[model samples]
Target: MLLCGLAAVVSACGEPAPRKTGGTGTARPGDRVTAASAVPVNGGVLVDLPGNAQLLVVQPRPGEFRAFNPSCPHVGSLVNPPAGGVITCPLHGSTFDPASGAVRKGPAASGLAEVAITLSGEDLVLA
Candidate 1:
């Protein structure tokens, strides 16, 4: 019970930390993605996700864009997003919901921590 509360605290307080200028490929958990690679400058784009992995961009419906990290929280492996709205890790086969980032499989019983990014007046505030 106590551990669950602590886990909730750790997950809820998760925000990307500032990274040094110039990064490549993917971004990590608690990492602030800039306008270089996945992140966007001119238009809205990639945002940070949990588990130290780059959140893949997904626009299921018009006017709504969702971001999810390809990595499974159970292991450090990448996860694949299904068309229906679930993310499955190729390594351990753990599944997570794209909307909530919650673990729907065993071994990774805990829910995946989701990062928040809101579009505030034409600006995507990831902080």
Candidate 2:
């Protein structure tokens, strides 16, 4: 019983069910994004993740922000950022609310992994 319990915890610790985009650095509470403070808003920003991963800043939600990975979690495919602020998996048609990358469909039980993010004076940091 002890071994079984330990195994279960370890398995769950490495990662949660893949969301539309999360698998690397995630933005938990108390995190913030930083930049030059005078760059062009048009370009926005990009953040690096482990495993050759990267996330791009697309939208801002004030106290929160949204980011999309060039990869998809449903089938190791690529995922697209939200349409009208809703993230969706292009591989399996799973949709997530960027504000809270939670699953909004079947074939997907996990929410999108959070990419680090912060609001720097009206700019959404893709941290």
Among the numbered candidates, top lDDT falls to 2
Q: lDDT per residue, candidate 2, 24-118, as tens digits?
A: 45543443444434222223234554444456444444333455554545665655645665556677787765555677874776765666555
Over 4 Å off, model 1: 1-53, 58-66, 120-125
Q: Identify the runs in model 2 with alpha carbons over 4 angstroms from their true place.
A: 1-51, 56-60, 66-71, 119-127
- Quantify all predictions' global Cα lDDT against the true fold: 0.51, 0.54
Judged by lDDT against the true structure, how good is candidate 2?
Answer: 0.54
Model 1: lDDT of residue 108? 80
Error of 2 at 56 (Å): 5.0
lDDT of candidate 1 over 11-111, digit per residue (tens):
99887775421112343333444333333222223334344335544444444544554555676665554545556667877877655667888678675
The ten-residue window of minimal lDDT in model 1 covers 20-29
**Worst 10-residue stretch by lDDT in candidate 2?**
36-45
What TM-score fits each model? 0.48, 0.48
